[model samples]
Target: MRDLTSTEEFHELAANSPVVFMFTAGWCPDCRVIDPIMPEVESTFSDYTFVSVNRDAFIDLCIEKDIYGIPSFLAYANGSESGRLVSKDRKTQEEIEAFLSNLSK
Candidate 1:
């Protein structure tokens, strides 16, 4: 997963292709819990471009998008939002996979 560098980059990526932005932060335990499984998840859903966005660095963007949670996922396809799995709860691998799977439908 690529780390988000700038807000401009976020917009450019979202507009260009199927992208999944993962909102996370260093201090978030829930975010770290899924770190080990992320590589596998990315491979399982190879069609989408995965990005890691630090909640601290992009607080403004988070507020704009109404993301009041850590370890959230926002998917974009064809320049529009397709789905989201936003919450303050810890996400299991199955749940993450299910969310991505549902996005395809």
Candidate 2:
């Protein structure tokens, strides 16, 4: 996944492609669990945009968006919020795929 390190990059990405920006902290167990499997998401949605945001690096944005939990997925289409899939319990491959596939249309 591409690293979205700055607000400019985040906005640019969200505005450009059918992107999914994941808000996760490095220390979060749920994030660690999902990290390795993200390659599958990247491959599956090769035509769509996929990005990652480090919560520690961008806390203000996270709070502004109310990203209270790790593994929160902010799915955007042309810079708008299309959907969200969040929480430790819901961060699964199938869940992610389902959300991405449904919105990809």
Candidate 3:
């Protein structure tokens, strides 16, 4: 997954393709847990572009997007939000896969 450096970059990417923004932080254990598994997830969901957004670096953006949770997942298409897997609870690979699966429906 590519790291989103700026909000403008995120918008540009989202405007063109199906995007899944992964909101995470370096200190988040849950985020770390998913890191190793993300390669496979990305491969599985090849249709979607996955981008990583560090919550600490983009706190204001996170707030603007109402992403209050670490390791949150938000999907977009044509620059519009399609679905989200945002929560304070820990996320599992199954849940992440399910979230992506449901987005297609």
TM-score winner? 1
Tell me the TM-score of each prediction against the true structure: 0.97, 0.89, 0.95
Model 3 lDDT, full chain set: 0.91
Residues 21-103, candidate 2, lDDT per residue (tens digit)? 89887788888988888998889888777888999999988888888788889888866888888665648888888888888
Candidate closer to the true structure by TM-score (higher is better), 2 or 3: 3
For candidate 1, list the clashing residue pairs, or say none: none
| Predicted candidate 3 versus true structure: per-residue lDDT over 1-105, tens digit per residue | 999989899878778889999999999998999999999999999999999999999998999999999899989886688899998788889999999998852
Q: Which ranges in model 2 have alpha carbons more than 4 Å from their true place?
A: 88-90
Root-mean-square deviation of candidate 2: 1.5
lDDT of each: 0.95, 0.83, 0.91
Highest-lDDT candidate: 1
What ordering of candidates by TM-score runs from best to worst? Answer: 1, 3, 2
**Can you tell me which runs of candidate 3 are displaced by over 4 Å?**
none
How far residue 42's Cα lies from its native spot in candidate 1, in Å, is 0.1
Model 3, position 55, has a per-residue lDDT of 95
TM-score quality measure for candidate 3: 0.95
The local distance difference test score of model 2 is: 0.83
